[model samples]
Target: MREEAPRTVTAICRALQEQIECGLLPQGGKLPAERQLAEVFDTTRITLREALGQMEAQGLIYREDRRGWFVSPPRIAYNPLVRSHFHAMVGEQGRVPETEVLSARIVPTPAEMCARLELPALSSVIQIRRARRIDGRLVLYVEHYLNPQVFPGILDFDLTRSLTDLYASHYDIRYGRVAFDMVPTALPAEAASILKVTAGSPALLITRVNRDQHGRVIDCDVEYWRHDAIHVSVEVPD
Candidate 1:
């Protein structure tokens, strides 16, 4: 029985993968309920969940809180080397992009953020929290920390607009030096909850730090993305 269950889970994963790839399970389509699926597979709910998790980690599917699993849409191609903001990049990929400003306020900088921005201890920065969706599916939760000295009264504007455009038109500041650090990590509870996934779900964390034209560190962003939602592609000129 033990050996039989392991093979059954593998069989279930394979069968569903084929179905999804063949378009029987269309992208963005919700999967049957766990109980229904378990019955179809002739397996217990526990085994079915294991199979679903395997597929989720493989970027083949995703699960929402209180909603069942869903066939994942095509992953967005992200080229970090290019200077593009969230909305621009999503639009270029032929996907509808939307952002919701969760909160924006001046917050005392934490030690880690202060060091990253090279700001003096105890300095506060404009912290903007946002949730972004692609094709109307929540996929990213991000926070922007900007040097208060560089952008005064920025909080007065609509926070959902691209920061890249605002930097040029509102402040006449262009990014000169930028750096990115990426790592595979477990999504924090705050971000995962906002994305409608379970806490500690698999995710990719991309940390971006930027300097203005005069070499002054102006802002940094911590972006938490659904691991399956983006395919990072960097293009280089030879």
Candidate 2:
């Protein structure tokens, strides 16, 4: 018989991250006690503490003095292009909006993403690819990168649901400032498949990054809007 290698805290954290993202553990809920978690993972309490510490730093869980650790709520959505929720945009047109969370995971931030986030060095980012629809017709494709350390359980929430409401109700995030950059581009191969469009089709590529009240980077995203489908009319504040 072969002996198994002892589990480390990093491994435990990754497992927990995966579970949270997959909804195995519900959001805003308490995590298992240290003793129980250690036993479950076949690890030591010290290692479990280390793993929990990393998660705490990432805003995934908070430890009460007497109580145990609990998962943090989901983050809010603030569009730099306009002062509106994607849901609100569809609602105004007398259309219902639906979202399909295509893909999501935790990975090292790419160079471009690091620059947008203004992160010092390489950092972990939460990657989310989703499609937005109006009247059951696909209209918008979004790729969002959030600071994994700042928005824990990001993978756990039902992303088909509205993230904007989740941020406000769970984390008390009010609103965010907006900045946008737009470009004309041909649709990439992968994006075309999900958007149900032909490759190299004309599209509007808009990049945006959101900041909180304290000026912390909350989220950065790129949106691909089909040129033939929808155009926007904006109203400025008085």
Candidate 3:
């Protein structure tokens, strides 16, 4: 009976895997409830969940809080040095992009942040938190720290829109030098909660520092992304 149970789980996994591969289960489509799925697979709930867990680890599916499992969309390709904005980049790949500003405020800069921006101790900065979604899937949460002195009254503007455009129109500040450091990490509780995933799930952390024409740091951004939702690509010249 033990040997037969293992084979049953494997069979269930293969059956569902085929559906996903064949597009019978479309991307972003939610799977049926656990009880329903168990019935459909003709297996015990425990065995069915085991099969589904494997698929989740394989990046074939994901789960949302209080929601069912869903087929994951194709990973977006991100070029670190590219000047494109998030909306433009996602649109180029035939996906809809949306951004929601979670909060914005003028806060005393942390010691490390002040050092990064070359500001005096305890300088004030505008901090913005935002969530980004692609094709209706929440994929990234970002925190931006901006030098308030450079762009006074910045908090008065609509922050939920594209910051790139806002910078150009208001301050005529375009991107200059950008530095990126990316790593795979376990999602923190705050980030995972916002993205509707389990805490400590696999994720990607991207840290960026942007400079102006004069080499003065303008902003520091930290992005937390779903590990299965993006692929980083960049070209190198010999």
* Reference-based TM-score of each model: 0.98, 0.63, 0.92
Model 3 clashes, total count: 0
* Candidate 1 displacement at residue 16 in angstroms: 0.6
Give a tens-digit lDDT track for model 1, residues 72-190: 99999999889889999999989999999999999999899999999998788899999999999999999999999899999999889999999999999999889999999999999
Report lDDT (CA) for all predictions: 0.94, 0.74, 0.90
Off by over 4 Å in 3: 1-9
Model 1 score (lDDT): 0.94
Off by over 4 Å in 2: 1-82
Local accuracy of candidate 2 as per-residue lDDT tens digits, 105-199: 99888899998887757788989999987666565799998887677886888877776777777667645676688787877987776777567
Error of 1 at 1 (Å): 1.1
Weakest lDDT window of 10 consecutive positions for candidate 1: 1-10
Ranking, lDDT, top scorer first:
1, 3, 2
Tens-digit lDDT track of model 3 for 70-104? 99999999998789889999999999999999999
> In model 2, how large is the Cα lDDT of residue 100?
89
Model 2 clashing-pair count: 1
lDDT of 3: 0.90
